[model samples]
Each structure stands twice: as structure tokens, then as C-alpha cells.
Target: MRTGFFTHADCSRHEMGGWHPECPERLQAIQDQLIASRIDPFLQHREAPPASLEDIGRVHTQSAIARIRDHIPSPSEHYYSLDGDTFLNPFSWDAALHAAGAAIAATDAVVKGELANAFCAVRPPGHHATPTESMGFCLFNNVAIAARRALDVHGLERVAIVDFDVHHGNGTEAAFVGEDRVLMVSFFQHPFYPYSGTSDIGAHAVNVSVPAYSGGDQVRQLVTQNWLPALHAHRPQMIFVSAGFDAHREDDMGQLGLVEADYAWLTQQIMTIADQYAQGRIVSSLEGGYNLSALGRSVAAHLKVLAGLD
Candidate 1:
């Protein structure tokens, strides 16, 4: 079976600014690389529909949703800031909706046997946005929202979210903190932006925050000593990943110093868990990565694993 690729044209319409790293071109870069590398041939494509208000409300408050909508500017005008680094342009809302919708729909497809697995390649890279705090170039917590929908709406128990974004997914961790049903395992740069996710949160949140320049070996050691044991013990019913490539040595977003091999191995480990416990059910969404070619190559590497072509 083919892995599903979910995205929308509207995702390309939102632009934060002229030189922002989190630009619409990120999506195009992934698509172009996939095409150029013949990686798209291994995946099935689907156009993501706009997410409903209820979908957004799954991980964001009603007031937060209203706040995001209240700031949409006229096409003639352009940009606004939700916070210091997170900016919005004329089409930001619609792009965010589709970015979120891609995850939701991909989750539905995988859980319903419509696809083997799915990858959402939409942007505005969500992982930093908390339920109440819209920061870190993210407006909505896309993977968190999808995981909740899969659990509550689809009646699945024991869902796990594994975030490998170079930066700590403070938002995802915050949303699922102290919740037994959902387990969030994250490895990120410590003392970084937002800088939260250090100690264990109750028992459900497993975070390993190390210093800058910790490379692939460090990631492997930490996962072996920490994540693997916990993951195998939990044996999750479904798996969701916040796949961020900023950890790559080439990307300056963070200083984790990981590469494509690290991503591939980590993905393979998750796939092994999915095969054993979750019936190979997994859903992943792109989170962060600034350098264009690095993002493309790393995404290709990641998706190759998702498709089991590696």
C-alpha cells in the first residue's frame, strides 16, 4: 500500500514576510525535491480540505480561534504578528486551516484503512503553538489536534505522539501533559526558544533535552537509554510524529547536529513499533527546517522510511 501525502494549494498562499525562513516556498521545495528525486512515485497524493472550526477547537480555545480570525488583513495590506517571531499575512488563516486539515484527514485515512500511513507536508510548522499561546511561527497545534480527534472522535485509546523536532514541542507536551491516554516523547535542544520540556511531566510526558551540537550518536544513545524502553513498555495503539528537520547540521534553526541517517533510523524504530503494536498505523506532519535543500533532502529521507522503501 502507498503512503498518503496530504497538502493544499492554499498552504502556499500564506507568506509571513519577504525573507522569512518559514515561507511558502518550503512546501514547494519539498514537492520539487520529491518530484526531482522520483520520491513522489512511491506516494499517493491528496488535496487537503479546509479544517472546520471544531477541528481547530480540538487543540485551541474558542477565544484563540477567534483571535486568529480577527487578525486577517486585507490582501492589499499583508502581515501581522501573533507574537515576536510568528507572523501572519493575508492568507495565513486559510493556510493554517489547510495545514491542520491535512493532518486530520491523513489520520482518518490511516485509521480507516484508506491508506497504509500518511505524511502531511503543509507549513506554518506547528509544534511550538500551545493551546493558548500561538508562538514559534505556528498558529495551531496541528498534530496535537489530529491526535485528539483520532482518540475522541474515532474512539481510539492509547495514542502516542513522538516529536523529533530540534526544538522542544512545548505546545504538544503542554497539551498532553499528565494525560495517561496520550504519551508524548520528545528530544530537543535545551535552553532553546520557549525552553520548556526538561524534566518528566508526571509520567506521560517523556522529554530529553540536551545541549547544542549533540549529533546522531547522542540521539541514538538517548533514545536507547530513555525513549525505546518507555515506548516498548507503553505499546501505543496509534502513533503521531512531529517530524522537524531543523536538527540537521546544515540547518541553523537549532544546534542538535543530526543528519539524514539519524532521521532514517529514528523513523525505522517508530515503524517497528507501529508494526508490532499499532497495526502499522502512523501519521506524521512536517514541523521545522529552514535551509531549502536540506529540508527537501531530509523530508525525502523521512518519507522514504514512512513508505518503507528504505
Candidate 2:
């Protein structure tokens, strides 16, 4: 069995502007780090396909998809905003679709037993976008989309989405609130951007909102206490992760301080669950990580764990 790596060149094409933190270079940093660390040699690579309307319809409303597609500009210059932080450029439409599609394909591969697990390395990160609106430099909520696809298309009875991003997965929570058969657990800096996952949205939402500068201990506690218990109870058939490294101290995007070992430990924990209840079935995608060095190192460590090479 091999771990699948999913990405696309168009992900590099989707840039907001020259000064944006969510630049195309983020993917390059990750790719270079994976090769330099020699972690890229042991994985199965796949080109990400564009997600179709039916696939995206699993998570986003048709109107939202229509609005996004209608906003695509002619190859020169185009701009639109669902929020001040998230913007669309000329190639953003294609990039966003591919980012989403990578997650969908990875989910299918893992659930169908085509691969042991998968990782999507594409960009224009999702997980902040809700069903009706996009926010937080996110447009499609990739993990949620994969979860929904697993349940709907693969006919899986139960699935779990674990988001370890520094910020709460508000969009994922919103998408799955009160929805049985899907369990979402997340921990993020409280009073953070798009702050809404703290309180109970309904019966299905489990949030462990932490404060800033709270580092590995709090995160470890959440995983061991809040996440593991719920996961054991749910007995998910598959697991999906919104793997974000922006919580690192070097990353000013979020205030929480996490490091490479933290990410490796988190991946180890989740992979254990996948091995136990889900037959080692897992699909992870990159979410947030700003500082180039920290982001690359953290992601390389994570992939090392994912590929069982660490």
C-alpha cells in the first residue's frame, strides 16, 4: 500500500496579488521541502482534476457555485471578494476547483481501497468557506466537501473530519452542524478570525476553543481528550484532516505556537485511528501555514509520518 500525493500546477496559478500571504509560492515551498527532505520519493503522485458541478454540489449550494463561476474573469485581470481577506483573480476559478477536486479524488481513492491513504498538496486552501459564503482565504471548504462525498458517493455510514488548524474550522462546522453520521472536532485560537465555532451550533458540533500562545500541551490535550473520545464513540469508517501549520510560532498568521513535531504527532494520532477503525483510510489536505520555513518543515514532517517514512 502507498500514500497518494495529489496536486496541480494551476494551484500555483491562483494568486491573489504580489503581497498576499496566500501566494502560489506556498506550494513551491512545500514541494521543495518534500524533495529536499527525501519524503517525496515514496509516494504515489496524481494530477488533480477539476471538480464537476455535481461533486461540488455535495457541499456548496448551486447558487454559490454559479456565483463563483460567473465571476471568473478573462485571462488578463479579474477580481472579486466574498470577504476582505479572500479574493479571486483571473485563474482563481480554475485553481479553486482543482483544490477542491484534489480532496474529492483523494477521498474516493482511500474509501474505495485504491490506496492506503492520500494527501492533497494543492493550495487556495479551503475549510473556512461555508456552504453559502466564502471567507478566510477559503472558497470551497475542501475537507467538508470530501466528507460529504464519502458519505454520499461512497455510501459510507460514518465519517470523521479532524481539523488541527490553528483557527477553528468555522466553515466545516457550519457545513456539518446537526448532521448525523458526520462528526467534526476542531481546536483553534479563541476570539479568532471568523469566530463562530466556539458555541454549540447543534448536537453534532464539538469544538475545543483554545487561547493564543497555548502551544503543544493544549493541542495534545484536545486530541487525547476531546477528539479521541468522540472518534472512538463515532467509530468513523474514514477520516479526513484539514492539516494546517499556521499555528506555528513562526507563523504570524495565527498566534498559537506549534512546531514540526506537533504536526508529526498529530498525524501519528490520526493515522492510528485510521488503522484501527477505518482500515488505515485517511485523506489529509493542506490548510494554513504562512512562514515559509516553518510551513515547509512542518509539512515535510507531516508527510513523512503519512508515508510511514519517519
Candidate 3:
């Protein structure tokens, strides 16, 4: 089985604005680097299907879904602001659906053994959208939805969510804080945007709050000393990753110092855990990588490891 690569054209059409860092060009950059790195052909590509309201409602509130569905702007209108940073254009709704659908589809494919694992390269990057609200450029919580799907639909007893974004995945934590069936392990830069992972996270979560300018060595240590022990103890039946590359030194979105090699190492470590307990089933979704060049290179490195090309 190969690594499935899931995406959708609607994702590119969901732009916030010309000045936004989370532009359509982010997907193009990943594609460009995958082709340039010659890793594109190794991936089994799949166009994402739009997620149903039922699928979305598993992780989000009905009111939140209604709000997003009702607020989509007409083509004549450029955007509708959900918050200061998140906005909706005419295509934003479909894009958000497909972005989330990519994660769900990838989860299904991996769970069914159609693929060894999968990477969802779609966006309006999630991880910031909570159950009752959409914020930080996210319309839906993609990874959270995927994790829920793995448990509720597939009957998985144990699952893990790993987030290495620069900012805390406050939304994801909120979704599965005390759920014994889920174990969420993550390391995020502290005192950052959507800042809420530092205190009183439940027993089901192991959240490491690191300082800005922290390097790969620190992350590796944290993963080994913190994430790995908890992951092994949990023995997750499947693993879902909220893969974010903005921690790269070149990405101005945050001040962490991770590089491409660090990303490859991180994927390898996660793969090790998945192999041991999850039968190598992993579903990863894109989140928060801004620097075009760095994002491209970092995603390639991460995918190379997932595809066993590294």
C-alpha cells in the first residue's frame, strides 16, 4: 500500500485576501516541491469529496455549522469576516468542506487498508476551530473530526492526535479533553496565538508548552521524554497528526527553529509509534505553514518519511 495524498481544487479557491499569509499559493508550493523532489509520483493522489453535515456535526456544534453555512457570501461580495483573521468568500464553504473531507477520506482509506497511511494537503487549515466557533483561519476542526471518525465509525478503542504546530491546538484539546478513548500528544510554542494549552489539560492529553526560539533538539527531547511514553502507554489503535510547519526557522508566523530534517525526524518518530500499535494506520492533515519556500521543503520532508521515500 502507498501513502494516499488527498486534496481538492476548492481548497485553492478559499482565499481570505491578497494580503493574508495563508494564501492559495501554499498548496501550490507543496505541489511544486513534491514534483521537484520527485516524490509526487510515489504518492497515490485522490481528489477529496466534500464532507457531509453529519460528518462535520460529529465534532462541531449544530449552531456553529449553521452559522458557517448561512454566512457564505455571494460572488459579488469579496469576503465575510468570521473573526478578524478568518473570512468567507463564495467558495469558502465548499473549500472548508472539502478540506475537512480530505481528512475524513484519508482516515477511511487508511483504516480500510487501501493505503498504509495518508496525508491531506487541503486547507483553510484547521486546529484552531473549536466546537462552537471558527477562528484563526479555520472553518472546521479537520483532525478532530478525523479522530472522531476513527473511533465512532470504525470502532477503534484507542486513538492519538499529535499536533506540532507553533500555536496550541486549543480547538482540538477542547474536543477530546477527557475522552478516555482518545490520547492527544502535542508540543506547541507557548504564549502564542489562541493561547490556551498551558493549564489543566486532562489526563487524556499530554501538551508540552515550549518557549519561542526553541530548536529541534528540544522538540526531539520532548517527543522522546513526553509524547512517546504517553503514546506507548495509550497504545493507540490509529494516529491522527495535525501537521503544521510554521515552526520552521524561516516561517515568520512563529519563532521556533525547526527545519526540514527536523520534520522528517518527527514523522519518523510518529511512524514508529503507529507501526507498533496502530498497524501503521496514520492520517495527517495540513495546518499553519506560511513561508512558501520553507513550507514546500518542510512538507516534502514530512511526506518523504510518510511515503517511505526518506
Candidate 4:
């Protein structure tokens, strides 16, 4: 089966500002690179549907949902800042909904045998947004909502989330801290933004934090030593990836020195786990990557692994 490619045009309209690093151009970069790398034609592309409030409410609080809805401004109005970095424009709510919806749609598609695996290319990158709050350029926790759907709607008992973002996925960790059914493994640059996941995370969370300026060797070593052992023991039923490429050496967003090859290698490792325990079912969503060139190259490498072309 072809891998699924999910995205929406509304994702391009949810910009925080002209100078923001999390710009809409990030999606365009990925698309352009996919075409340039000759990988676009090998996948099943789908336009994302907007997520219902009921779907979002499964992972977020009622008050948080109300705040995101209430903060939507008129088309002629200026953007409303939810925090120092996060903001809501007229189209932000729609974009956020579709970004999350893309994740849910991908999950449904993979779980129902319509596809082998899927990648969500939507924006307004989520991972920092918690259940009751939105921050760090995230208004909704997209991957968390999808994992919940896999568990609640698709009857999945053991779901796993692996995040490789440059920053800690504190919000995603918060959503499933003590849930025995879910196992989360991740590596992020330490002593950085959010300043979390350093220690004291619950048993379900395997947060391997590396010092600033660490490179791909550290990532490989951690996966071999820490993440692999945990994943093998857990034997997850489905695997979800919070795929973030900001750790790329070219991206100034974080100090981690990961390159495109690192992402491809890591994805191959995850694929081995999927083949072993999950019937090759995987869902991945874009989270953070600032440098356009690096983001595009890294995503293409990751997609090549997902599509079995590498």
C-alpha cells in the first residue's frame, strides 16, 4: 500500500507574523522538496478534513477549547497573541482544526487498511500545547488527539509516541504521563525552552535528554541503549511519530546537530519496530523545523523511509 500524505491549504493562513520562524512557507518547502526529490508521485495524497470540536475535546479541556474558539479574530482584525510566541489569526482556528484533523484522518486511514502508514504535513505545529493550555507556538496538541482517537475510536490498547524534536514534547508527555496503555520515547536538546523532561518523568515516558550541541551519534546511541530496549519490551500496537526536524544542523532553532541522514536512520529503526509489533502501522505529524532548506531535505529523507523507497 502507498503511504498517505495529508495536508490542507488553510494551514498556510495561520501565520503568527511575517518574521516568525514557524511560517506557512515551511509546508511549501516540504512540498517543493518532495517534488524535487521525485517522491511526490509515489504516495497517496489527501486533503485534510476539519476536526470536529467533539474530536478535539477528547484530548483537550472544555475551557481550552472555548478559549481557542473565542480567540478567533475577524478577517480584518489583527492577530491575537495567545502567549509570547503563539497567536491566533482569523484562519488560525480553522488551520489548527485541520492540522489535527489530518492526524486523525491519517490514523483512520492507516488503521482501516487504506494505507500502510501516513504523514501529516499540516502546520501551526503542535507538541508544546498541553491539555488545558496553548503555548510555544502550538494552539492544539495534534498528535495527542490522534493517539487518543487510535485508542478510543479504533480500540488500540498499546499506542506509542516517539518524538525527535529539538525541544522536549512536554505537552505530549503531560497528556499520557501515567497511562500504562501509551509509551512515549523522545530525545531533545536539554536546558532549553520549556526546561522540562530532565527527570522525574513517569515510567511510561522514556525521555532521553542530551546536552546542547550534541549530534546524531548521541541520538543513535540513545535509541540503541534506551529507546530500543523500552520499545521492544512495550511492543506497542501502533506507532505514532511527532516528527520534528529542527534538530538539523542547518536549523538555528536548536543546538542539536542532527542531519538528514540521521532522520532517515531513526525512521528506519522505528519502521523495524512497526514491522515487528504493529503490522507496519505508523502515523507521523510535522512538529518543528525552522530552516526551510533543512526542513525540506529532512522531511524528504524521513518520507523516503516511510514509503519504503530508501
* Structural RMSD, model 2: 1.1
The 0-to-1 C-alpha lDDT of every candidate, in the order given, reads 0.89, 0.87, 0.94, 0.94
Candidate 2 lDDT, tens digit per residue, 1-310? 8999999999999877788898888899998998899888899999999988888888899888877788876766567766677888888888989999999999988877888999999888989888988888888888888898999888999998988888888888888877899888788888888776867775456788889899987789877988888888888899999998899989999899888999999999888888889999999999999898899999989888988999
Q: What's the TM-score of each model vs. the native?
A: 0.98, 0.97, 0.99, 0.99
User: Ten residues in a row with the worst lDDT in model 2?
Assistant: 73-82
Give RMSD to native, each candidate: 0.9, 1.1, 0.6, 0.7
For 207-281, candidate 3 gives per-residue lDDT tens digits of: 899999999999999989999999999999999999999999999999999999999999999999999999999
Error of 4 at 212 (Å): 0.9
Alpha-carbon deviation at 255 in model 4, angstroms? 0.6
Q: State the displacement of the C-alpha of residue 245, model 4, in Å, after optimal TM-score superposition.
A: 0.4
Tell me which residue pairs clash in candidate 4.
Answer: none
Residue-wise lDDT of candidate 4 within 66-92, one digit each (tens)?
898998988888698889989899999
For model 3, the superposed segments whose C-alpha errors exceed 4 Å read none
Error of 1 at 292 (Å): 0.7
Give residue 287's error in model 3 in angstroms. 0.3
Clashing pairs in 1: none
Cα lDDT over the full model 1: 0.89
- Residue-wise C-alpha lDDT for candidate 1, range 109-222, written one tens digit per residue: 999999999999998778988888789999899999999999889998898899998889989987887778998888999889877887656778788988998999989999
Candidate 4: list runs displaced more than 4 Å: none
Provide the lDDT at 193 for model 1.
83
Which is superior by TM-score, 2 or 4?
Answer: 4
